[model samples]
Target: MNLGLTPSVACVKPKPEDSFAISFAPLSVEDVYAKADDPANGAVVVMSGMVRNQTEGKPVVALEYQAYEPMAMQVFYQIAAEIRQKWSIVTRVVIYHRIGRLQVGEISVLVAVGCPHRSEAFEACRYAIDTLKHNAPIWKKEHWADGSSSWVSIGACETQGC
Candidate 1:
């Protein structure tokens, strides 16, 4: 079922063994991992991107994320599909991205990959995140304590403390 969700987000649970568990809201880091947890899969990899307290020597109080929801969701699916194609042993994949304001230390994105072995799981997880950062239509704005904000590309940030 599609859940009739906003086109900006994709929350699809295709199947327990092979699925792209995607979401575009405040995400539970633990839940993202759980989606890939299975006895049949011997290895599971999890990655979480969080909002930090500082960026480029400036004190960042919070972050505001915006996305072209429909395109972002499509990118998530594409990443997961690519993983499945390259790693046939992969049992599951979950990619969750958050939007709107996020406080320091809050999770902004999560990628979990499950496979029959540790190496494949790790590789798939890494590829999923890297691809998302480069391909996803998501943008972030750093909110500094000095009452300033700047739009930054996800993978092109030059901040020292980001």
Candidate 2:
């Protein structure tokens, strides 16, 4: 069987044991980099997403995350396979996403990819996030200080402000 990444990317919510460290609170770039380190890993690229206070000019109080665990896992595995097959330089990659209660200024997700060179690492890491956003089942619920909240769906406009 070929252990190669597919042309299309998939996203998953990795198990804690399979991940460097998985938590609902926040993610750390340093932690991801530390786990991604290896003798064979010459280059490491890291991406961190922070919870912004505003979306479309509105203030966000807090956020809740939910996911479809089984599908999420499947997507993640496919992503790993695809990356391995497409990129010769990339050796390993780690993607950590938080699903649960999260506050502002907290890390929502982290992606780290290691390769033989910086370019490959960067490409793989970037691809991971973009694909995850497109394919993952993770959803966000934004709470407002005015005693109101709304479930923010993926692909929705939450960039303005919460």
Candidate 3:
């Protein structure tokens, strides 16, 4: 877990057996939601983004994801910062997004937010995903049946369900 936390920001201490749980992984939901049992985090909001097998009514074979690492990390930090600034009650926020080849139903991204209040957690969680879609510099290539692949250049405005 490359938690790039700086001294300027609040240092996140590993939850003491009861704080909160948030995760993203290529494995399974069990691995991702291991912290759900934390008692301190009363509310847990989980969001999973999956790769669809079909695109534009076409039969998709596979997908390849690419990301500009530096920019993507910046964007991820920005989203987390925005969520914290916008909400006063968000306790813990976890987001995991993958960059590589993917098949249908593969989990592309996962976000989880824990807070004392359910409303704040929900708002922050949703905001994180929406912002990531709009800001992350990640691209995808769709493979078709005939061995042709096309890139999906998702701009900030277009990706946020705009």
Best by lDDT: 1
Model 2 residue 58 distance off true place after TM-score fit, in angstroms:
0.7
lDDT by residue (1-162, candidate 3, tens digit) is: 868844222333333322222223364555445643245566888888888878888888777777765556666666666777798666666667777888888987777777777888888889988877777667789998778899885534255542
Give the Cα RMSD of candidate 1: 6.9
Q: TM-score: which is higher, 1 or 2?
A: 1
Cα-based lDDT at residue 12, candidate 3: 35
Q: Which scores higher on lDDT, 1 or 2?
A: 1
What do the candidate models score in CA lDDT, each in turn? 0.79, 0.71, 0.67
lDDT of 2 by residue, 50-128 (tens): 7889888889878888876565656566666667777866766787888888889888888888788888888888887
Off by over 4 Å in 1: 1-25, 155-162
Report each candidate's C-alpha RMSD, comma-separated, in the order given. 6.9, 7.3, 7.0
Ranking by lDDT: 1, 2, 3
Per-model TM-score versus the true fold:
0.81, 0.79, 0.74
Model 2: residues with Cα > 4 Å off, grouped in runs: 1-22, 155-162
Question: Of 1 and 3, which scores higher on lDDT?
Answer: 1
What tens-digit string does per-residue lDDT give for candidate 1 at 1-162?
Answer: 887755433554344354443344678867877888888789889998999999978999999888776666677777777788899888888888888889999899888998889999999999999988877777789999999999887732222122
